[model samples]
Target: MAQARQLEQEQGQGSFVQSVKSELFSPEKRQGNLNIALSLSVFAGAIVFLRNFGELLAV
Candidate 1:
């Protein structure tokens, strides 16, 4: 009986992990992640441009 309970718990844990992995790598999540990365890159580029502009003005 104890072995059966342990096996059930192990199977449940495995399925739970698989479900989480699927959710993490789903298409919608990937798109959202890509959008976030693109936005961050754009933001960084803008900051760099502004800094360069400020240096030019200082000189």
Candidate 2:
């Protein structure tokens, strides 16, 4: 009971971390945070595209 109360305080109200804990770190919650994901998508896309073009330049 006390542990549940402590979690709400440390992780913040309705935060990603708290939700992640609640969900037992499932893949769905792992992908829930958008800001962390955008950069990865951009990077992966850029890499794939650059490899096709044989250039490291940004599209």
10 residues in a row with least lDDT, candidate 2:
26-35
**Backbone clashes in model 1, listed as residue pairs:** none
User: What tens-digit string does per-residue lDDT give for candidate 1 at 1-59?
Assistant: 99999999999999999989887788868888788889999999999998878677675
Worst 10 residues of 1 by lDDT: 50-59
TM-score of each: 0.49, 0.39
**All candidates: CA RMSD (Å):** 5.2, 8.1
Please state the error at residue 26 of candidate 1 in Å.
3.3
Global local distance difference test of model 2: 0.75
